[model samples]
Target: MMEFRSVQGSLIEAEAARNRARETRMRRALQRILTAAEGVPGYAPMNWSDVAEVAREALDADRPAGSNR
Candidate 1:
C-alpha cells in the first residue's frame, strides 16, 4: 500500500541520516586522536589493530554500565 511505501521510505531516510552522523563523528574522533598523537615524541601512525583497540576503548568508555551500546 502507499502508506507502507511511505513508512519504508521514511525508515530508509532515517537510517541514511544515522549513517552520515556516525561517519562524521568517526572522522572528528580520528582527527582529534591523530592531532594529539602528532604532539607525542616519535609518534607513529596507527596500524589496523591499534586503531581497532582505540575504537574499542572509546566505545567502552562511552558505554553505560550494563548497557550493550
Candidate 2:
C-alpha cells in the first residue's frame, strides 16, 4: 500500500537519520556509566544476582535482618 520513489537524497537522508540515532544512544550510555561511577545511586552496583551472591556474602559478612540464610 505504498509507492517506491528511488530518489538518491531520500536514501542518504535515511542513512544520516540512522547514524544520528546510533550516536545519541552511545552518548547516553557513556553518560550513564559516568554518573554511576560518580556514585549517584540511580544505578544498581551489582549485576547478575546469582553470580554475585557469593562475592556479596563474602564481602558483607553480616546477614541482613530476618534473612533465612
**Candidate with maximal lDDT:** 1
| Model 2 vs. true fold: TM | 0.52
lDDT of 2 by residue, 1-69 (tens): 133455666888998997786666556555655565566876754344533453444434445567765
In candidate 1, which residue ranges exceed 4 Å CA deviation?
40-66
lDDT of 1 at 39: 66
Can you give the lDDT of residue 18 in candidate 2? 72
lDDT of 1 at 13: 100
* Candidate 2: regions farther than 4 A off: 1-6, 46-69
The clash tally of candidate 2 reads: 0
Residue 4, candidate 2: alpha-carbon lDDT:
42
- Pairs of colliding residues, candidate 1: none
Tens digits of per-residue lDDT for model 1 on 13-58?
9989977866776776686568656766565667667777767765
lDDT of 2 at 12: 83
